[model samples]
Target: MAQVASLFTLFTHHAKTFRDLVYSLRNSLLKTGVFTNEKVAEQQVVSVINFDIHLRRDADGHRYIERITECVPVEQEAGYPETFRHKTTTEEKMTAFMETMLEYFRRSTDRPLYVARNVIEYRDGSYVAVHPLSERSRKEIAACLAGPDQAAFEAFLAVHWGDSDEN
Candidate 1:
């Protein structure tokens, strides 16, 4: 349950980051006259790159992100009435948008929390901590678990649970 909560928290954070990036790009394009108006820019942003994140737990009690869908808007012909037209060519705008989104994805994925279940599941020695541990503490725990022998495991117990022989 706690792992699910953490995943939710990270998802929310990343969602906000994605939204902000889209809006910022819209504003920039609007200033540059690439878009005729703010409304059209916003529509393009919504249609171009939208993210949907879901949290799921496997049967083995491992919690993870079930899916992340990146939806792109459909293209329509330019001759339609009452349709939003771009000040510039659609291809150019789309190219810029794709580039920006790619950069954002690169940066976001650099963080451990932003990783998906598929990659994490197959990772050697990967395990989710149910307790609320700081990022540093989690790394330390992983290091301890990765050590060569029983002394390392005992050290982990002593550091994390205070389970020394005296106790």
Candidate 2:
């Protein structure tokens, strides 16, 4: 029981640490961009860590995980914060919107593609593992980054085919 409790604590801490690490890296990237002045909040691609532990007859247990999903905006529903507001008098609403589009591009395609799961291999050379991305999802991610607007790209797809289809 104590071991299980300790493991849970470790897992939660892993989530917080991962979130902070990604946030720091993202802030650094946005600052260096040409449109740095454009927005306050940037999208963070997140991975949901779902871990399963199974105990064997020998009392040796292991964990398994799902594949890495592509990036989605950090605050998809909340949108940008007030801090992203334009400072210059010359900046118009449209400019802000365009700046947003640009910011989205910079974030959605930048470095640190995968958020590694917290699992670590034990001394016995056995690992409670995490997933690697599949080839199909990787290609879709690339295609999304290649376009100007992600929403527009999705809209184009929706118009032609349908949203229910994953591919």
Candidate 3:
């Protein structure tokens, strides 16, 4: 593979899971006065950290990658599909606002702020891709690819993701 050099930052952490790493970073941002709101701090962490590369050492004293998790940012959609700007009545506006707030509350109750899942894992003494990149992630990658590399990347997506047309 050809190398494209850029800023490559690596550090060792004892986090057992991707969520733990994200939580730690979020708390760090808050305690350092970078962000006051917990939610904002969490979102910032999630967006910034795209991947978590974990490692493990075997009994033989050989260290290898355990898993590579991809941090998928949760799409922050508006609470309600309808906009309250056109609503003239006070009762109607109040109802719309309450409905939006209820949706947000339900989302927090049901799902996490963001998702982190392993895209690659080491099994049977070999590295393997366990999950495919999400559509959003695929698009982001495609956008970053140059025209010369686009065809090859599309072929890779087809083989790996079983997708070709959209990307």
Candidate 4:
């Protein structure tokens, strides 16, 4: 049960980090006009992904492949009217948006919360659907961010979830 709790906690941390990363990217684009002003203010940027993990051994021992994906709308049309200033602006904006998002996603990889979900499970129907993060969990995670005690935090989660399981 403790093991399960630790896994759950670690997964929760990563989930939040990923969520924040998307928000950061979205804000960057919105502030710079990559997305329409109204769309950026009124519409939320939604993210969904199917992730997997595996255990294998090689000359360098085991490794992990983690992928984080976000869904954003784009125009697929190729050619446009030569005199269409709006279309030209849109295309340039799209290029800038993609570049910004890619850079943000890359930086997310260095975050411990994102990189340390090695023990998590992302299978369908495996979620418990609780609030994204509890107050205590959020506080602990923030502290970890400041000083980096991820392993200790993982252990704390193990105890927390273990108690819940026994009940």
lDDT of each: 0.46, 0.41, 0.76, 0.39
Question: Model 3 residue 1 lDDT?
Answer: 8
Q: Estimate, for each residue in 126-159, the C-alpha lDDT of model 1 and write its tens digit.
A: 5422223233334444665545654675565456
lDDT of 2 by residue, 112-135 (tens): 344334333233545432233233
User: Best to worst by TM-score, what's the order?
Assistant: 3, 1, 2, 4
RMSD of 3: 5.5
Candidate 2: the clashing residue pairs are: 40-84
Question: What's every prediction's RMSD, in angstroms?
Answer: 18.1, 16.4, 5.5, 17.9
Which candidate number has the best TM-score?
3
Which one wins by TM-score: 2 or 3?
Answer: 3
Better of 2 and 4 by lDDT: 2
Given candidate 3, what's the lDDT at residue 10? Answer: 62
lDDT tens digits by residue: candidate 3, 1-167: 01135333466678888888988988988999969988888887776676789988999999999998888887787446465666889999888878777877887766467778787799998877667777777777778889878778878766765653431
TM-score: model 4 vs. ground truth = 0.21
Clashes in model 4: which pairs?
A: none
**Worst 10-residue lDDT window, candidate 4:** 110-119
Candidate 2 TM-score, true structure as reference: 0.23
Best of the two (1, 3) by TM-score: 3
Clashes of each: 0, 1, 0, 0
List runs of model 3 lying over 4 Å from the truth: 1-11, 81-102, 108-111, 164-167
Candidate whose lDDT is highest: 3
